[model samples]
Target chain A: MKAEKILEALGEIDEKFIEEAMNYNMKKKFNWKPIIAVAACAAFALAAIPVANHFANNDMVDGGTTAGTVAPVPGDEVDDDVDYVAYEYSVNKGEIIGNHVVELKVSKSRGRYVIKDKLDTQKTVYLNGMEWTAKYENSWSETDYKVIVDRYTGVCNGRNMSFGVNSITGKCEFFMFKTTGDIDKTVKLTRDELYEIAYDNFLSGGYTEDPENYQLSDECSNGSAGYWFKFTRFVDGIETSEHVRIGLRNNGDLYWFVGNRIGEMKDVDVSGFDMDKIYDAIEIKVKKIYGDAYVDFEREGAVLRKRTDGSYVFDYSGHIDVKNSYGKVVQERCFLIVIMD
Target chain B: MTDETILEMLFARSEESISAIDEKYGHKCRKMALGILGNEQDAEECVNDAYLGLWNAIPPERPSSLAAFLYGVLRKLSLKKYRANTAGKRCSYYSDALDEIESTFASAETVESALEGKYLVEAMREFILTLNEENRAVFLRRYWFMESCREIAAALGTSEKNVTVRLTRTREKLRKFLEERGVEI
Candidate 1:
C-alpha cells in the first residue's frame, strides 16, 4: 500500500489488456451514420435560416408625420386644473445620429397616457400642464434625450405631493404622493408624533420597516390605503437614505412599494424646480449658516440628508411628507422633498 | 476521438481499434484500475475485461465518453474479482476494505449490488469532482486503485496519518454527497 507501489502500478498498464479490449470491441456491430447525418443537418438548418432572414430585411423605412408640429417655447399657457396635454415636435435631419433616429411621440388626454417612439424625423410629447417646462437633452449612447423638469407641489386627499423629471435620465421620479384631499380640515401631525407612530408600528410588527437604520425626515406619502416613509441614517459616519412604502389592505395584508423615488412627481408641475441646483445652493447656505451641523430636508416624500463632512444622500417614499426650504411642512400626509446640507 | 469512432473501429474487428484505445486512454484506465484492485495482474485482467465488455456493448450502445465507459467497466470487473477471490476470507485485504466502507453502504445488502448501475458511478464521479483536486487524486489512488495510505501520503507529499485523515473525511463527504443525492449509500 505504499506510494511507490501505486505509482508503479499506475505506470505499468499491460498492452495485452488493450489488445483483448480491442478484439472485444471489434465483435460488436451498430449503424449510427444515419442518425448523426440527420442531427447535423437539423443543427445547420436551425443556425442558418433566421440569420439569413435578418440580413435580408436590414433596409430602413421612412416614417410619416401628421399635421403641424409644436415647437419648444418658454412660458406656454397651461390650464391649472388640467392633468396633461399633447404637443408635436420634430428633430431636424441635422440632429439625427448614426444611420437612424427614433422620435418618441407622447400624448396624454386627461390622466391616460401613451408613448410612441418610432423611427422617424419628428417627435411629439403629451405632457401634463404641471410638467410643461420639462427640457430634454440628447445623449450619444441612449436614444431618448435626458429630460430635466422643474419641481412642483400639490394636495391630494389631504396629503401634499411633489414630482419631477430627472435632468439626466428623462425618467419621472416621484417625491411625494400623500393624500391631501382634506389637508385643511385634518389635524396635522408633528415630526415627533410621526416618529412615534413609526416606532410603535415597528415594535408591534404591524409595519414592515427597513433593516437599515435611517434617520426619520418630514418626507412621506399616503397612497390608496396606507402610507410611505423615508429616512436617512449615518452608518460609520456615512449617510445613507432608505425609503419604504407600505400599503395595508382591508384584510390586513401588507404590501411593499419601495423604490428610489417617493412618488411619480417628476411627471408633474414640479418640473420647473431644478432640484440639483436647489440642493447645491442649500448645501452651501447650510454649511455657511449651520456650521457643521447635520442638515436634512424632506418635501413630498423625498428625503435628503447631509453629514458634517459634506457627504449627502437622497431617498424617497410614497407615504411621507414634503417639506420646504424653511423646514415648514407643506404636505399634510406623506410626500418627500430635498433637504439642505 | 469520439466514442462512435472508437466503437465503429472496434465493431469492424480492426487491430487499429486496440492501438487507438491504448493510445488514447490505456495509461489512465490502467492507473485507475491499479488504484482499486492493488494487484497488477488483477488490474490488468480488469482492463482486459473492460475491452471485452466494450466490444460486446458497442453493437447496441455508443458511449458518449469512451474513457469513462472503459473505466467503469474495469472498476466493476476488479470489484467483482476481489469479492469472488476473497469470499469468506475474514483477514484478507478485501475484507478489511469492505469493513471500512460497511457503515456507509450498510443498507445495500451486497457490495456488488451497491456498486452496480449508472447511479453509483454517477454519484462517485460527482463526489470526486466536489473534492479538492489533491484530495480527490489521493482518494482515487487509494480506494479506486487500491493504493496504500503510505503511497497516497508520499504522492501528495504528506504524512501517512494525514492521508488517513483525508481519506476518512473524503469517504464521509462522499457518503453525505451520495445520501443527499437520494442514494441509499
Candidate 2:
C-alpha cells in the first residue's frame, strides 16, 4: 500500500482514542537557555569587533575580576572587514587565523539542538557573569545589556548560583552557581530530590505554578539548558503546557533554573488551507535571510504556535549546513524553520 | 474546576457538568474542531455535540483524563462533519498533519491488510511504542495532536526545523517498519 493508503488506514483509528492517549498528554520540554545565551554571546562577539580588540567595556565581573581583554594587536585598525577571528583559548591547536579571537576546537558535537543527538561527555562550561547585546551593525535590532551566566558544559561541583536576564526576549534564563571542583564532584540528583532542592532554594516564593496539580515529568531538558529536570502541573484534570526546568549537574549541583517555559504549542488555528503557499513563503524567507551562508537544508517538520494576539504562527524546521565566508562550515545545525509572524 | 471536580459533578448528574466542561475545555474543543472542519458553524456544532457526547459517556466511562475524553469527542464529531459536508476534502491542520507523515508509505505497495483498519492501528500503536522518547513525542505531536512544527519546536525548545526533520524521518522509518513487518502500505 501507498502512504496515502496507510493514512487512510490510520484514519480508521478513532482520533478520540489517539486524543486521549496522546493529544491531551504533555511532552517534557527541553532547555534552550544555554544555546540562546551562548549564541547571543557569539552574536555580541561577532558584532562587537572584527579583529583582536577589547569589547571596550572593561567590565568588572561578579568576583571583582576583569574578563579577558587583550591589547589591540598589530594591524587591528587595518583589517576592518573580517567578521570574526579565533578565541583566546583556541590558539595552540592551529586554530588561529590572523590571531584575533578563539575558534571553538570542537572535537565532536553529538547534539545541541538536533534530535537524537547526545554529547559524548556531560561537560559544563560557564560564561562568568557576562553581559551581551544580541544585535549587529547590519541590523537595527539592539537588545539591552543583560547579565547572563550561561553554562553549557558538563555537571558542576560548586554551590554559588546567580540570575541573569536575556534581553533578546526579556526573560531570565539562568540561575547559576559557582564551580568549586571538577565533574567528579557532581552528583546526580533524583527527581524528588531535585524538586526538593529547587523548592527549598528557588521556587518557594516566586513560582507561579500551583503546586497542587503538578507532577515531575522528566529529569532533563534540552542540550542548551543543560542538566535540568522538568515538572508538569495540571489544572482541573487537564495538564497545562507550562513547565519548569531547573538546571542541575550530574553531581546534583544547582546553578540555574527557568519556569513556565512551554516548548510545545497546541490548539493552533489551522483554519485555512494553503500548504504549498506556506512552504513557498518559508523557503523564500530562508533564502532571503541566509542567502549563500546557508549551504543546503533538508525539510524537517512543521508546527503551529498561537501568537499572543490569538492568531497562529506556522513554522517549519530543517537541518542545514551554513558556511562562513572562508568556505568553512561555521554552523552545522538544525536551523529552526524560520517562524511566520 | 479540576477534572476530578468536574468528574464528580458528572457522576452526580449535575446539570452544571456540561457548563463546567465548557468553561474549562470549551475554547480548546472549539479550536480543535475549527482546525478539523475549518467551518465556524461546524466547529460550534461540534462543541454542542461534544457536550452531549460527554453527558452520555461520563456516567459510564470515568476517563482518567477528562481533556482527552472531551477532545476525543469534539475531534470525532468535527471529523464527521468534515467528511460528510466537505466531500472528504480535508483542508485543515489535520490534512497537513497527514501530509507530514504521508511520505513514509508513499513508495509501498498496497496489501490486503491495508483494508483492515484495526490491524493497521494496532501495528501503528506497536510501532509507536518502539520509538525513542524524542521521536515518539514528535510523532504524537504531529500525527495525534495535529500540531504544527512550530508548536512541537516550542514544546521541545528546539527549532521548528528540527521538529519537522525529526517527524519526517520518523514517518519514513514507520513506513519501513510496516514494510518489514509484511504490512504493505
Candidate 3:
C-alpha cells in the first residue's frame, strides 16, 4: 500500500476531530455552557436540592502515610459537576503592546468571614502579628503595599489567624481561618472528605451566598501540610480570581483556611478578550529573564477574575522549567505567578 | 482578533484578513509545514499559499473552526510539496510517519486493490472515534501534524518514550481495526 494514500486519508478525518486534537491544551473548554446552565438551574431550587453530596462523603481519613505536596491537578469529580469557564482564546502575535488598566477597588472587597476560633491561644497570634509588605504587579503598574487584615470589631475572636488586605486598594487580600483544634498525625482525610469540609467551611464562613456555584480547583491533594482543597469562585461563567483554600490535618481536622472572595465584576466578556496576549506576555517575560535559554512555560492554570470593585483580574499560574545550554533542566518545575493584570 | 472577525473580513474580501491570520497562526502554520517539508523556505511558501487558500475558501465556505480549516489547507499544500520533492530531499519526519501507516496496513492487502481512498478514510475515522481522548489526540498529533514524538511529548507534558509507545500501540489498534472492517490500506 502507498503510504501517501494513507497519509491523505488521515488528513480527510472530520474537522471536529481535528479541532479536538488541536485543542488538547484547552480540552476543558468544551461545550461547558450546558454544564454551567445545569448548575445554575440547580442553584435556583436550593431548598428542594437533595441533601446527598455529589461526591462520596465517607469519613475515610485513614489512608496514605506520607503527606503529599499540593499541586494543581485537572479533572476532579467536581469538575464534572461544577465546570470552570476558563478564558481560553488565541492572541495577536507580538510584543507587549497596548495598556489596559484593571483597577482593584476597596469598596468591592466586602466579604464577611465568621472567624470561629475554638482555642484562646489563637488570640495572641492575631494581636502580636508582625507587619508584612509585598509588591503587586500587573502589566501596566507595580506597587508595594502593606498587608493589612481588617480588625472587624465584633468578630476578632483571634480564630481568624490572618485577614489580609492590600493597604492601597483596601481589597481583602486574603482571610485565613485556622481550626486551633488538636492535630493528630495519623489522621489523613481523603480528597472527597476534605472537599466536603472545604465547601462547608466556605459557606459557613459567609464567603458567598451560593457555594455550589464555585468550581473545585483541579489541584486538590493530601500532602505534608494535610488534605488541601481549593474551590474557585465563578461569576457569569467566568472563573473569578476569588477562591477558598482549605487545609486539613491528616486526622481530618481543619488546620487553616485561606480564602479570597471578590465582589461582582461587570462586563467580563470572555469571548471578546484576547487570551493570546497573556500567553505571549508570559513567554516574553520568560525569554527576557532566561535570555533565550531553552524554556518550557507549561501552563498549569490561567484565571481571569473580578476584583470586588468590578475590575478584571488576570493571573497566570504555571510550571516553568528552564534548561541550560546543555539541555539539562537547571530550573526544574518552579511555580510562576503573573499576579492580576 | 477573533476568528469570526477574521472571517467577516474575509467575507468582505479585505487583504488584512490574510495579515490577521498570519499574525495569529503564522508561527504554528510555519512549524507544521516545516515538519512536513523539512525546509524553511518551502514551509514559508506553503504557509503563504495556505493563507491565500483560506482567503479563497472562506467566502463560499464558512468553517466552524478557522484554525482547523487553515491547518487542513496548509497540510494539503505541504503534502503536495513533499510529494513533488526528490527522493534525497524528502523530509524524514513525514516519511517516518507515513511509513508507520504503511506498515499498519501492510498485512491487509486483500482489499487494497478494491479500496477507494474515501473508504479507507471512513474506516480510519471510525477507528479514531473509538479511541479515548488521550490516545486519539496522540494519534492525530503524530500523523496529521507530522510532529516528532519529542514535540508531541513536550506539548502533552509527557516523555518522548511514552509518546513513542502510545503511537506504536495506536498503530497496532488501527491495523486491527481496518483489518476487521475488511478495508485494506
Candidate 4:
C-alpha cells in the first residue's frame, strides 16, 4: 500500500474526526482566584509595611514595643476606604506585566495585609475572627517572591496546606503538606473517607466534572508519603487520558492534588459496534505491523470527546510501541482504531 | 457567527457570508494551507481558492459541518499546490510527512491485485474512527490537515518528537491495516 493512498484515504475520513482535529479542545479559562491570591499577598505585604514602620518609630523613641504585637488601633487610618492595585507580575520575566489589576479588599478593622521583608518568615493575622497566616519563600537564586498562603482554608496539626499556582495561567498546580510526627506511614483514613474529602475539595475548588463519570482507584495507600487516589475518566467502560490525582497524608490530611482538564471526555453509546471483534481485529492488525519485531503494548483504551461543534467522536482506541530485532523502537505510540460502522 | 447562520446566508446568496466565514475560519484555513505549502504567498492563494471552492459547492451541496467541508476542500487544494510546487526538487516539510507514510509500505516487492480506492477509503475511515481522541487528533492534524510536526505539536500542546513518533507508528498501523484487509503494496 502506498503512503499517498493512506493519506488520500485519511482525507476521506468522517467529518466528525476532521472537525475533532480542527480544534485542539485544550481551552483553559484563566483562573483568577490564584492570581487574586497572589495579588492579595502583595497587597497585604504592602499594607503591613506602614504599620511595621510605625512600630519601629515608636520603639526608637520610647522603647514601648518592637516588631511584636503591633496591632492596628481603633479609629486609625485603617478604617479609610483604600484601593490597592495588585498587578499581575510575571515571575519568569522578572517584571510586572499584564493590564489586569485585581483590587485587593483590605479589611478596615483587623484584616491588615502584613508581610515582612525577611525571607522564610510567617506572619499570622486575625481575619473575620479566623487565624490567617501569610508565608513567603524567597529563592536566593531568583529575585521573584512567591506568596503561597492566600487560599489557605485548611490547617492540619497547626500547619496550613499550601498550593502552588501557575503565575501566568492562575491554575492551582499542586498542593503540598508534609507530615511532621511519626504518623507519616500510617493509613488514618479509609478509601471511602479519602474519596469524600477529595471529592468535596475538588468540587469546592470550582472543578466542573461530574463525579459519576470518573472511576475511583486507590493507587497507593501503603507508601511512606500518603494514600494516592486517582479518579480516571472513562466512557463506555473505556478509559480516557484525563484524570485527577489526590494524595493524602497518614493523618487524613491532603498532601498532594493535581488535576488535568485539557481534553474533555464525554460518555457515548457504543452498543452499535461489536467491541470484541474490534479488539480482535486491532490485535491482528498490530501483529501484522510488527511482524517479528518486538512490540510493547502499553495500553488498550478508547477516547470519546465532544468536539467544539457539539458532536461526539469516540476514537484513539489503543497505543503500542514497535521495536526492531535490535530492540530499538522503530515506531513509538502506534495509534490504532477500528470502527465497523 | 454560527455555521447555520452563515450557511443560511450562503444559501440566500448574501455576499456577507464570505466575510463571516473569513471571520470565523479564515485564520485556521490559512494556517492549514501554510502548514501544507510552507510558504505564506502560496498558502494565502490556496486559501482564497479554497474559499472559492466552498462558495461553488454550497449551492449544490449542504454539508453538516461547514468547517469539515472547508477543511477537506482546503486539504485537497493544498496537496495539489504542494505537488505542483515540489514537482522537480524535493520540498522537505510536507514531503517529509508523505515520505514517512510511503516508507511504511514502499519496500514491498510482491505483486498482487490492487485494492479498490473505495474499499481502501472505507477501511481507512473505519480504522480512523477507532482511534482515541488525542491520537486521532494528532493523526488527522498531520495527515489530513497536512500540518507539519511542529505545527501539530504546537496545536496539540506536545513536542514535535512526540508528533513525529506518533505519525510513524500510525503510518505503520495504517500499512498493516490495509495489508491485513488484502490490499497489495
Instruction: Note the residue pairs that clash in candidate 4.
Output: A1-B185, A44-A113, A315-B131, A315-B132, A316-B131, A316-B132, A317-B131, A317-B132, A337-B130
Indicate the TM-score of model 3.
Answer: 0.44
Task: Score each candidate by Cα lDDT.
Answer: 0.41, 0.48, 0.54, 0.53
Stretches off by above 4 angstroms in model 2 are: A1-341, B107-115
For model 2, state the Cα shift of residue A206 in Å: 34
Q: Evaluate model 3 with DockQ and give the value.
A: 0.23
Error of 3 at A195 (Å): 28
lDDT of 2 by residue, A1-341 (tens): 24444544544444445543332212224233665655654543354354224323444322222333332231233222221111222112122111111122221121111111122222223232122211100000001111112222222222222222221222222222222222123333534565577656444633343555566654444332225556666778888877655555422346443333343334365556565777677667656545656566555566655534444456443455555433456333332323454
Q: Write the per-residue lDDT of candidate 3 for residues B1-185, one digit (tens) a residue.
A: 45777899999999988887876678678889988988999999999999989988888999998989999999999998988884655556788887777776664455455456778678767888899888888889889998888877655545788888989998888767766776554
DockQ, in order, for the candidates?
0.02, 0.10, 0.23, 0.20
Model 2 chain A, poorest ten-residue lDDT window?
A135-144
Relative to the unseen true structure, what is the Cα RMSD of model 4? Answer: 25.4
List candidate 3 stretches off by more than 4 Å: A25-139, A142-341, B107-111
Q: lDDT by residue for model 3 over A276-318, one digit each (tens)?
A: 8766876776666445553577655666655453355554444
lDDT of 2 at A310: 41
Task: Rank candidates, DockQ, best first.
Answer: 3, 4, 2, 1
Output the lDDT of residue B181, model 1: 66
Q: What value does the lDDT take at residue A76 in candidate 4?
A: 30
Q: How close is candidate 1 to the true structure, as a TM-score?
A: 0.28
- lDDT score, candidate 1: 0.41
For every candidate, C-alpha RMSD to the true structure in Å: 30.2, 21.8, 21.5, 25.4
- Summarize candidate 4's per-residue lDDT along B1-185 as a digit string, tens digits: 35777789889988888886876577677877887788899999998998899998988789999989998899889888887887656564567667777677764333113654687688888888767787888888877777788767755546789888887777777777777877665
